[model samples]
Target: MAGQSKLSELFIKCKSENRAALIGYLPAGFPNQSDSIKIIKAMIEGGVDAVEIGFPYSDPVMDGPVIQEAAEVARNNGITMAKTLEIVKEISGTGVPTLLMTYWNPIEKYGPAKFAHDFSDSGMEGVITPDLPIEEAGVWLATAKENSIHSIFVVAPSTGDGRLKDVTSNCSGFIYAASSMGVTGTQTNVANTASILVERVRNVSGTPVAVGLGVSNRAQASEVAKFADGVIVGSAFVKAVLQNPSDPATAVRKVAEELALGVRER
Candidate 1:
């Protein structure tokens, strides 16, 4: 575990446990600064093998209403890049592999090299830039590689087989397979499209695949666990914290535990 990249260590740990990995996402500053950090720790304690801390952007074109609203709260509360790094550093200290999930535009404005160094310095394992296409990621990849940070790319259901290989080639950790075609949010049922996309990615790269975008409750997590190497719970966790802001940590903890149990069913 110490020898492998943190992301690799997570996959290896999950495999050894005979279960898929559980990844939970939360904006760096959702309800408030104090509650956000507490919520993340609660997530790890509940059973997340890894965490994705969202760097809230004003225009989150790829996010659903739940996540977009969370972004608004974070930004409105004065959550800046500095505050996000502070939160990342604290969460990384929990010994769970932590990755910053953000839009590529923020990295461009912050300078990829500078951002990579800050992330590494903050004890982050890596990053997941959902919007950074492989065609335009050469410099960012180089910067991340230089800092020993893993790069994860999204492999959509619509992606061609050739493009799937291209995207996987740029990925150093695992591939994030959006379960549905639309933006990120919870759905009543896990998308059947994810299994197909995962199979396609497997044909090209052996990297672990995590299904994201629609997973909500434990049953859905169990559904995705059948196919993916990991189950990513984002919008649901964000929604939990958003709904119970006064007790966000407990809300997040309960959801994380459910997702963790679901993954263990495999």
Candidate 2:
């Protein structure tokens, strides 16, 4: 469990193949539960290294328009914490590593200990809560760690060396280095800023660093991989599915393949 649960080792495995990991993100129950499973399976078949299953939260402050809209639709479709857990089990059966992307409120609502135990039992590998700060991570970190679930931490471009080291030290999985100091979504030409941020984070932490937030294309992903071990693409894929939910599996496959190739080409 120790070696199997660490995200950095997973990233290194992907790196050894001369390919950056392609992490796909989708809101659980996006178009509906049926479609969500289809998309997850599509991503796995299309070569995605991992998947980030988003739990719908009414107010996802850090997510931008695309993800925010998808979350709203998921919540409207009656997607709840319990439903997400069930989805985790289904996805796990597909043999692709999965992480739950969520907020703190829902975990608290479900009781941290119970949530962690149940989630681990259901086959989730880890969790990413951008809103959970280093100081407050202690609130749920222990429960998560007890179940061998990695607690993913986020470090922003604005984070100084001291805070960066502190956050990375507490991180068991790969550290997410936000490409910018803003919400998740599309952005124009972030190469320069991304390079500096990646170097800063790499210098501070031995953990594998993943670059996320505002990455939308192959070109951008390739550029980011030059400085980091993994690339996390979310909004672009979610927006693609929302555009054609009836056949989201196809869209997921297409995007996943494209991104996978993009990273592998690097």
Candidate 3:
């Protein structure tokens, strides 16, 4: 059996503190490789509990405009699978648990076993493949198990009770609960359905649940934190970098700090 991952440890620590973990996301090589590394370090300095590095896919169906733009910038700057893994190595070295959020095509093209092993070697504690379903995740799950890494899965408000059980059962680190049934982005108000989805996931499994999508500010983070084990913010962070091209590191750090306060306040 695979041992407990850093991601699992983070959730436990957060639970003990009576607060939700703050997870921040950034695409590898966004703006540029060297600067991207600095930006990730800044996020850590700002109290982000965990990090999710995007793999910069050409067709990110689940990503919103902010994230898609970041991915495009990273791709145009020559970000590749190898480069992404290098970024993972640098950030994971900070002792903060790191995860890669990517589409299934990249993993399929890279070869599942090799991909899993390489990712594990890069110090990533888990992987979140949004497009891959539980029924089709047999090989990937097995390889992730062999690597002693967690196979994270997504559960949305639209997920039915039966399917929720199957999906959560296959997940190891945490179950990603999409707050709404839409592409990822920041919203003025988080959907009420997020809490409902979290409740359903709890009824089916004991895995920690993290709510993502539509969470951009501290208030939204605090609201979600009230019911979730973790709060994931992506587009908001990407937007911060985009808005402050002169010094994206500082920009993202500020956003991380604000969101961190939100989670802790909850």
Minimum summed lDDT over a 10-residue window in model 2 is located at 1-10
- What does candidate 2's lDDT look like per residue over 1-266, in tens digits? 64575355668688788767878888898867877888888887877888889998998999999999989888888898888988999987777778999998999999999999999888888899989998988868888878889888888878888998898988767888888878999585666777798788778777777889988887888887777788899998887888875687888788888887777767
By TM-score, the candidates rank as: 3, 1, 2
Considering only N, C-alpha and C atoms within 3 Å, which residue pairs clash in candidate 2? none
Worst lDDT run of 10 residues, candidate 3, spans: 1-10
lDDT to native, each model: 0.88, 0.83, 0.91
For model 3, what is the alpha-carbon lDDT of residue 32?
A: 89
Whose TM-score is higher: candidate 1's or candidate 2's? 1
Q: Put down candidate 1 lDDT per residue, 58-175, tens digits, no spaces.
A: 8888899999999999899989888999999999988888999999988899899999999889988778988889889989988888898888888888899888999988887788
RMSD to truth, every model:
1.5, 1.3, 1.1
Clash totals in order: 0, 0, 0
Compare the candidates by TM-score and give the number of the best one.
3
Could you tell which candidate, 1 or 3, scores higher by lDDT?
Answer: 3
Error of 1 at 151 (Å): 0.9
Native-referenced Cα lDDT, model 1: 0.88
